[model samples]
Target: MRINVLQHTPNEGPGSILDWAEVHNHEVYTYHPYQFGHLPTADETDMLVILGGPMSPNDDIDWIKAERKLIKELLDNNTPIFGACYGAQQISKTLGYPVTKAPAKEVGWAPVHLQSHVIPGIPETLQALHWHEEMFEVPDGAELLFSSDAVKNQGFVLGHHVVGLQFHFEPKPNNVREMVVNDFNYIPGSILKQTKEDILATKVPEENRAVMFRILDYLSQ
Candidate 1:
């Protein structure tokens, strides 16, 4: 299977998704439309994986707007997609639901309560990294999958194939460190948000990769 990634920034790669793809013998390709303006062709992408970024989906930037349009087209065609953080906001915006600033900016490891078994095997209340101030609204006819105490809409599934996750379950320890170093300036005083040192010190548990692979396995089928 060809699992293609829509990478919004240079620092945020596919991380554990790459590991899952490799383990399953799926071909992986990433398009850096933010830097190179290279977009993926639909013919080459069996599964579309959208990665997180600092930029909002509401940004008036040309590439960001173009990405939302592409997402709309692919979703209309019923393509399998998995979106994380900013990527999740893009998917929601493309689906006619607005992406708005959350009541709080969750910026560290927190518990996400599973609303349903939309993605089977994920723990009911699992620890996940939350790094977004903006949150996606659940689209019409979609199942509300997960929610954190800080963010009500942590994840959703529009159909059997379309999944949008507002949390970071794909980051490795190095990836987490890089992400923390990259966006360390913002200091929102939400109780749910944690300091850089604490976030960095917290281990990336095996369940993170396991849950990531479980989602990928379902998406690829």
Candidate 2:
């Protein structure tokens, strides 16, 4: 399958997802709106994976607006999509759900409790990477699958193919380090922010890699 990925920043590129795609022998193409500022039509993609970024879905940027249009087209055609953090917020906005800023920023490793059985292989609770301060309601016709203490709507699913996750399941150790180096200012004043040493010590990535593959396989089906 050809999985077209929409990336907003260089530091936030697909991590474990890239590994999974390679191992599964799926063709993966990435579009960087922050750089290339271009996007593909829904017909060019068999599946879509939107990566996280510093920008909010409500931003007034032209590329963001264009990406929304693309997302809507993909959804209308029932193309499977996996959205992470900012990517998820984009999905919510396209689905007519309100995306708002959270009261506090959720940084570092946090626990998300699965709230529904909409997807199998999702544990009742799992520690995942959290880097965004934005939150959104579960879109209409989507099942709320997970919730965190810091954010109520941790994840949601629209049908069996469309999945939106507030926390990232794709960050590897090096990826987290890059994020911390590039975006540390975003966490300078947050009480929930973890130190670089602490973030590097996390074991969450290894635990979540399998879960990420499970979801990917599910979407590929």
Candidate 3:
């Protein structure tokens, strides 16, 4: 399977998703919109993974608009898509749901309360990495899988192959560090957000890694 990942920024690349792709022996191709990388058509991609970024889905950018069009095509064709953060917002916008400012900016490790069953054997609550101020709304036909105290629509599941997570499950410890280092100012000094040291110290546990792998496998199916 050819899993195509859309990367909006250098720091926010496909972290553990690369591990999943390698484990399954699936071909993985990453496209950098900032660099104008060639984007393959929906039929050429087995799965599309949209990674997180600092930008908003409502940005007046050409590449961002183009990506949304591709996402719409993928949705119409029932292609498997997994979006995180900004990527998730993009999906929601293309699905006719508007992206709005979250109640509070959820940064670092926070617990997401699972509201529905998207993956089997999943915990009722899990500590997931988050770094977005804007949140996506639950689409008309999508199921609200889980949410956090800071944000209600943290995740949604559309049909059998489409999923969007407002939090960061794909980022490994190093990836989290990179994100923090690159955009340290984004994490405001608030009770809801975490400090750089605290965020870095709390490593991405093996449990979280396993859960991410399971979720990816579920979407790939």
Candidate 4:
């Protein structure tokens, strides 16, 4: 299988997803649209993984629009897509859902309760890394998979192949470090947020990685 990744920034690459793909001997390709405004065609990729970024899907950028177009085309063809944060917003936008700012930004570890078990392997309650201030409405016909206290639409599954998560389930420890270092401005000094040290101290990586593997395995099937 070939997995094509759409990366919006240099810092946010597929962490455990790439690792899983590599271990399973699946070919991987990446498109850094921020650096090169080009994207891979659906014919070239078996599955698509869209990673998070600092930018919002609502941003009126040329590349963002192009990526949305690509996402819509892929969904039309029933191509399996897994998205996180901004990537999830893009997917929601493509499906005619509204992506809006949350009442409060969630920036640390938070428990997301499972609303449905369509995705499988995810526990009823899981602490996922949160870093975004935006939340999207669940697309029509998509199963609302998860929800948190801060965000009502934490994740949703479209059919059996496409999933969009609002939190960072694919980030490793190093990925978190880079994100904190590079996007330091996002760290608000509020109760809902966390300090750099506190975030680095979490033991969510191993469990998050395992869950990510299960997600990929389901998508591949």
Candidate 5:
């Protein structure tokens, strides 16, 4: 399968998802809208993976608007999509869901409690990498899949094809480390409060990855 990844920034790339794709012999292509232009058509894509970024979905960026349009097109055609963090917020907004600031930002590793059987193949609890200030409301007609202490709408499913997650199931150890070291500029709040050491310590346990892989495999199906 040809999986197209929509990357929002240089630091935010497909991590473990890329590994999964390579191991499964799937072709992976990426479009960095911050550096490149807007997203391309999904003509050749069998799956769409939207990675996270520091920006909000409501940002008045031209590229973000274009990507939202592309997401709408993909949804209209029933193309499989998986969105993370900011990407998930975009997906929610494009589908008429409201994206708003959370009571507090959720950073580092967190636990998401599965709210429903939306992702039928996955288990009930999973630890995932989270770094975001905003949260989205579950779209109308979409089933809520997961929730965290900081965010209620952590994950949702639209039909059988589209999945939006507010956490990072795709980050490998190195990916998380690089994000902390290089992308620390994007981190808000007290810089001294959240150190690179703290971020590096964040991890998704192996059991969580097992459930994540199940969701990924289910979406691929």
Candidate 6:
């Protein structure tokens, strides 16, 4: 399968997903809109994976707006899409949902309770990486997939092919460290009170990768 990953920033790339793609022998391509200023042609790719970024979906940047349009096109065609954090917000906005600031930003690692209806194959609770200040309102007709104490609309599925997640299922230790250092500016005031040790202590459990893989496998099937 040919998977096109849209990267919104320099540090945030397709972490564990890239490893999974290589292991599964799927072709991978990356587009950094910040640096390259171009969106991929949706018809050219088999699947779309949008990575997280510090920017909000409401930003007036040209590339951000263009990417939203591309997401809409992909959805209209029933193409599969997997989006995380800011990517998820874009998907929500493109689908006529509202993306707004969360009352409190969910940073560090947090536990997400899986919706019983979304993925009964998975366990009830899973620790996932979160680094976003904005949250999406579930679009009409979308199925709620997961929720955290800090954010209710953590994950949602639109139709059969579209999945959006507010947490990072593909986090690595180094990736977490890099994100902490590089994107600290976007950390909410509440999270800023946390010490570096406290932040580093939080992480997605190893077992959660299996759940992520399961979701990918299900989507691909």
Backbone clash numbers for all candidates listed = 0, 0, 0, 0, 0, 0
Q: Model 1 misses residue 8 by how many Å?
A: 1.4
- Candidates in order, TM-scores: namely 0.95, 0.96, 0.96, 0.96, 0.91, 0.93
lDDT on C-alpha atoms for all candidate structures: 0.86, 0.87, 0.87, 0.86, 0.81, 0.83
Q: Flag clash pairs in model 5.
A: none
Q: Which is superior by lDDT, 1 or 3? A: 3
Question: What value does the lDDT take at residue 189 in candidate 3?
Answer: 53
lDDT of 4 by residue, 70-139 (tens): 8988999889999998888899999988889876788878888899977777778888888888988899
Q: Which regions of candidate 1 are displaced past 4 Å? A: none
Clashing pairs in 1: none
Model 3 regions more than 4 Å off: 189-191
- Cα-lDDT of candidate 2: 0.87
Which pairs clash in the backbone of model 6? none
Tens-place lDDT per residue, model 1, 26-90, is 89988988889877767666889999998998888998888877787788778889999999889
The local lDDT score (0 to 100) that residue 167 gets in candidate 4 is 91
Candidate 3 residue lDDT tens string, 14-93: 88899999999999989998688567789898899999888898889888889988999999988999999998899999
> Lowest summed-lDDT stretch of 10 residues in model 2?
188-197
Local distance difference test, candidate 3: 0.87
